[model samples]
Target: MRKTLLTAVRDARSGLALRLIAILSIAILPLGLISSYQTSKVLEKNGALSEIALLDRTRQAAAEERALIQSAFGAVEAISAAASIFDSADIDCDAVLSRLITMEPKYIFAGFVDTRGIMTCASNKERANLSETPFFQDQFANPGGLVSVRPMDATTGGIALNVSVPVVVNDDLIGRFWISIPLTLANDLLGESSDTANLLIFDSEGEILATENFGDDRRTILPQDRSLQEIVRGQQRTFRTHNRRGDLRDFAVVSIVDDTVYVLGSWEPRNTGALTGPSERISLYFPVLMWIVGMAVAYIGTNRLVIRHIKRLRQWMRLYSVGQIDFSQARLQSAPEELEAVADAFRAMAQRLSEQERRREEDIEEKTTLLREVHHRVKNNLQLISSIMNILIRNTDSEEAKHLLRRVQDRVMALSAIHRYVYMSPKLSMVRADQLLEDIIRQLVVVGSADEPENKVSMSTRFDPVELSPDQSVPLMLLATEAAINAVKYCAAANGGKPWITLTLQDLGEDHVKLSVENSRSGLAEEQDSDTDHTGTGLGSRLIESFVSQLDGTLEINALPDRFELHVSFVLVKDEGDDAL
Candidate 1:
């Protein structure tokens, strides 16, 4: 993955699309920055307004809760002012309290507690003493109107709000007139707007009084770092924090009753009603969308306007380099002006090169035809000379003169054969040496056999394909002719065998070749001495040496008891035009 990423980055640096994207991005950078700044400011302003709105909603919910509590307080105060309920024992306090409870369904229990913390009058028959309860003791010590949350009331046997007012007869506190209001009443009041917010009511002592729209997993949504008391300290204020579930929420704290009760409203920050859904999305994504659109346009435009044409030109150049000069100008006609000019230049160069190549081929053909004709004439002239020598040999009577004439005739025929092979070859500059040597050796064998027809000398020849220039082919042909003539002249059968001559041409690797001519020796001692005496003239040896020198070759001669062998090895020099062909 790392290597692939590095390679991608390197390619991107050199790619036209990426460069265009970078250029477009830089051109729009200031506009993007400005858009981002404006978005931040808009969001910040909306956020401030959202906080204020939350605080206001919290205050409204708190007011509703306070009104419910004050109503309970007012009922208790009104009942305490009824002197007949506290002062006149005959007024049937239980009946009046029970009647008050019946008239107000919010109150579950309404009664009066005397100074000794005894339930002297009661709405229900079941009664108990509250003197030992902390709320009763605090109320008795303070002796004023008070409101508190009761988790469980002894009279009602359920969660309720205890609203109390001191019962005074003639400025002497007789007992406390208290009413038990069900906590459900506060919940019902706050639940009306619970869909928009989660509400929780807390007393001065931080005791929860009621909750609205809270689920059983309330702990997850509630503040984790602070208690209700700490939060309520910031009265009429709003703040942000992450709930126990790690969700960021906005919270507002507002007083329901002065130093007595408070209500907290919490909701997710994303739920802020400052902007519509589409508006918010547009604000957040506008800059990024703009950048993407700009980059896309740049990439497409560059690929079409420049890259595609350049690629076409590059392909054409590649084909032209390999001699595929044929082209269509239709594609180039649509390219930009500068690229079209380049295409025109390349087309002109290819045409000129093609014309030059055609002319060169024509000149080579003309020269080769002329050269072949010259070789043909030379071969015919040499053959004519050999024919004339034959006529002289037939007409002369001197045996020595005929012998010399035949020798000269043999050399002339060898030269004629070399010219014949050169002109017959496909290439004027190179001749197949193996074929020329084969022809020359056959002619020499025929000539040598004719001198002594009774002997009927046996001959064997082997030739491997070898090519050479005329300069080397001529000397090589002459050398092989001389060797074959000597071999046939002195050949003798051994052990009752017929005289035989072997001619072999081999291609040694690395541009070198070897030619060998070997002939058997006679078993008779006198014939061997006679052969040694004839070789003393040194004419054939001298001719072989001179030919070898011309061919830039090495000569090897083996004169054994049974056979005589001559071998010539030389490098095959190739013509310069061979490579061009």
Candidate 2:
């Protein structure tokens, strides 16, 4: 029971059951968070709807203010239409203003100002000269256009908008009609907000025309926000609030009334009554926290259960990339069923590779054995041929015929020497080139000088060790032996009588070789052989040329005053029998 418990714990540490637990926790997180998530989304949507409704309210108020301005302009146009209003000399200006103010109670002042900056006809009983006021002085330069001015009130110490229209009759400019109203007229339109939100109105001239019911201590604000500026430029249609600079939760829009721009908005405080206490905020965010924790655990558990083992298996295979493969020594431990199957496949593959290598080694040994037997058979047959030639040479009585027979015997023995070396060496593919040459010259020197030791020719050789294929070495050895035999035969007539022959085998780098044979020769030797039926070289010359061609070599023959030299050079490619071809 204790072993079972330990195994269970190990499995749970990095196995499917732990992964399943992580997955279950992940699945439960969304269920826990759905209510809080929906509540947040609903609150966001309601906030947007409230902002839109507040914008609509400001738009309606602006439309009403536009209508009020048009009414005020119509009142001035109505009085300007009468011919008697321009005849200011006989007019009762105060009586006229009283009648006009009674007609539309919104307009408190109605009078005419002359070019001299004095009121010519009065609308009020307490009318002054009015030349000091900048509001009426601006009318003389622009005779018939409407203008607005903000003049401070004596009693309230606040400013009001004074609108004036130019008064002209029958191409005669008498003065201008003027009307003044307090900023309280704007507050009549914007009543009150439903919540803690406040309303404000401003013109592009940096004047806060009207604001919420700010008591004596209420702080009024001007909407100079970037969003409000964008609205004034007509680039942005509407805007929301941001507290990046200050706590300004004022969602506002812009309205253009008679070339005057107005910003109308509502203000919301930073920490509202909706989301107040710490516990309430925690309840809103707890689900999201649980979701993050659950997903993290699930990812770690799944990586341990499946991904980690896969990575370990990849590491095992990567070892083979560096030419190392040993399945037994690097055996994979127990794993999930699928991974165990992969490990089993790797072991089976390793077994097959070992078997293939063993069979390949056996094949190489068998081929080598067959090759050695071939060379041994060739050597014996050539030796039998050489013995028959020797027997034939002894039976012949003619000296010329015996000389020719000995030459044939020398060629046969050169062939036998190459096969002898191949069969003797452990490797059957190639024979040692230096030993093959030495053996060829050894047999030639012994047989050629055996009967004539009195005129014995000295033989000297230089050799460089190189390996040649059995086929190529046979041709090469024959070519060298033929040149050596010719030198031994020509030595008797050489002028110095110190008759000598030399063979030099040299290696030129990049797998090339040079073979040279030189013997002392004289004009007397040609005269001695001139009476003979065959000149010194008839058949041997042809045989030497054939071997040179077979080896893809170049041969040069030079017969100087007292010497004969034959030089042959050929390329030698190791481990390949097809170098020439």
> In candidate 2, what are the lDDT values of residues 1-581, reduced to their tens digit?
99999997986687664666666877786787786787577656655665556666556555655565657666776666673654567766667777887777787667666756666554565445656666655556554545354563421135555556666667777667666655577555545333444555555544455554434422334333453344466644344445343555655565645545464655563332232235545556777676667767776766765667777777866775555567676654546788778877877786787677668768777766776788789989999998998888889999889888888888888888888898797666667888888888887888778747676778899999988877678789888887787777776546656778889999898889999988886766664233211224566677778888989998787767787778889998565542321
Give Cα distance to truth, residue 147, candidate 1, Å.
Answer: 33
Model 1: C-alpha RMSD to truth?
11.2
**Model 2 local distance difference test score:** 0.66
lDDT of all predictions:
0.78, 0.66
Stretches of candidate 1 exceeding 4 Å from the true structure? 1-303, 306-331, 523-537, 577-581
Query: 355-470 in candidate 1: lDDT tens per residue?
Result: 88889889888878887899899999999999999999999999889878988888989999989888898877788877888778888888888987887888998899888898
